[model samples]
Target: MFAEADWVVKLVMIGLIVASIVSWTVFVAKTLELRKATLLANQVRQDADALRSLAEAGDKPALAGSAMVQGANAELLLSADALHDPEGVKERVASRFDRHEAQVARTMTRGVNVLATIGATAPFVGLFGTVWGIMNSFIGIAEKQTTNLAVVAPGIAEALLATALGLVAAIPAVVIYNHFARQIAAHRAVVADTAAALLRVVSRDLSRGTIAAARG
Candidate 1:
């Protein structure tokens, strides 16, 4: 059917096939990225939660990709002059966590817009191809002056092929985009929890009145 499709229809089918491939590629990459980030979040959250104080946690070496411990320790060193006020330090630390979390969310969602575009536009693009093909078929019927089923059927079948290809591309992209939305949301929550756990340790350290701070 595709082999007999009009040039315009063929182009649409090719583009949709490419779009579907791209969407799946993004799905695989984003899934792996989010999984790794969540794993690191969990690891750091557990480590931060076990800390007796930020000071004790500070003595430990930084985990390679985990940001909570490193960023928290950096904030402490930056605001060491104001460590006398736990409220002030906590406020700054909290703000830092918010910014970091936002950045992580942005990174995780990098390729998601491609999926959104494919989902929204693929059907319409395919419709255009089908419409063009049908118009040509009608023109051919006028020239040939025949209403025979065998003559009419091939054109219609080939035109509808474009719509089928469009749906093939669009449906899975919509599904993947939705799945990623939920996964990314859950990953973000895990990050927030990790930050909160570290913040609690910082509070404990500040309450202890330890003027000594660790540098990242």
Candidate 2:
């Protein structure tokens, strides 16, 4: 296997290995990041709800003071107001949702492109190495002025090695890319659910607050 490939093919195989490793690292890192973001968003939404409850009770200072919680509260308040005139509120809520969706998508998609690139390109990189090895093998046979299998054996082995290495690098990348794609999809689902929950909680709070003010 070692004898069949030319140096160039070996180099390509090495490069493919490096690329695969880099892509996998990105996948792992980004997966963790997305998970963290999802958790943080959910926590912030929950805190916002608690703060909204306190606010409705006329409690002083609440979690709404936190920047993250404040944003969620503002979004909720804006949405509840727009409910009375949906046409006006619809645009604003949709715009806010769009921005949040974009942020969630950006977080989920981190590092996936690199994984995709590795999956798509590694096989071809291996093929190039095999072709180069075969060419070198043929060249060796010609230089020896013989059609002997022994003269061509080393080049063929080198070509096969590169091909094998390419597959090794590419297979994991493809699998990992698929795995992360699913994970990101799941994370996005969580974000959507949490955002909806936040909207509902805020809507209720707004209604209560309005009733209290009316009675006073």
Candidate 3:
């Protein structure tokens, strides 16, 4: 059926097929990336809570395997006077966590725009092909001087095929784009919550350090 299409129609079909393929590919990649990011966010939140509990119990064990904890630890180690101003220390620690959270959000949402583009523009492209096919059909009718059904049927069929192909490519792309949008928004919320948990731990530690310094 595609081979019988006019050259312009053929190109349109090919473009729609490629767009569909790209949309599905992005869907798979984004799904995996979001899953990983969500898991990491959960792990970081749990580790931060554990660290906070340990601090309250007077046992500050080094936390490993969590980016938020590792970043806070690095900052604390680098600045001996970090606790001199508790607010300043909290700001710096929160900044570090925010950076990591932003990075995770970006990673989870990469390639999602491609799906949006395919969904929004594919149907229009297919419509163009249909219009072109019908125009050619009308031209053939004028040149051949015939209103015969046999002569017109093939052209109309080819024109309608373009519209069908367009819908076929567009429907899935739109559905997938919406799905990822929801998932990404939820993942970002999780990351924000995890960042908040880490910030609480940093604030508590800074407060303790400031009190001890004042007594010294």
lDDT of each: 0.82, 0.67, 0.75
Error of 3 at 118 (Å): 0.1
lDDT of 1 by residue, 1-216 (tens): 888877888899999999999999998898888888788777777776777776566455544345666677778888878877889989988998999999989988899988999999999998998898788778778878987777677778877888998999999999999999999898898888878888887787778776374332
lDDT of 2: 0.67
Q: Could you tell me which residue pairs clash in candidate 2?
A: 4-154, 4-155, 4-157, 4-158, 5-158
TM-score, every prediction = 0.92, 0.76, 0.87
Candidate 3 local lDDT, 16-53, one digit each (tens):
88988898888888788778867766665566667553
Candidate 2 per-residue lDDT, tens place, 1-216, comes to 653355687689779879877876886687778778667666655554454442442332323343323455465464553546534543454456557777878857766877778888888999999899989988988899997989888888888878887888888888888888887787777656655654555455445555234223
Candidate 2 TM-score, C-alpha based: 0.76
RMSD value for candidate 2: 4.5
Best prediction by TM-score: 1
The segments of candidate 2 whose C-alpha lies over 4 angstroms from its true place after superposition are 1-7, 41-69, 75-87, 205-216
- Order the numbered candidates by lDDT, best leading: 1, 3, 2
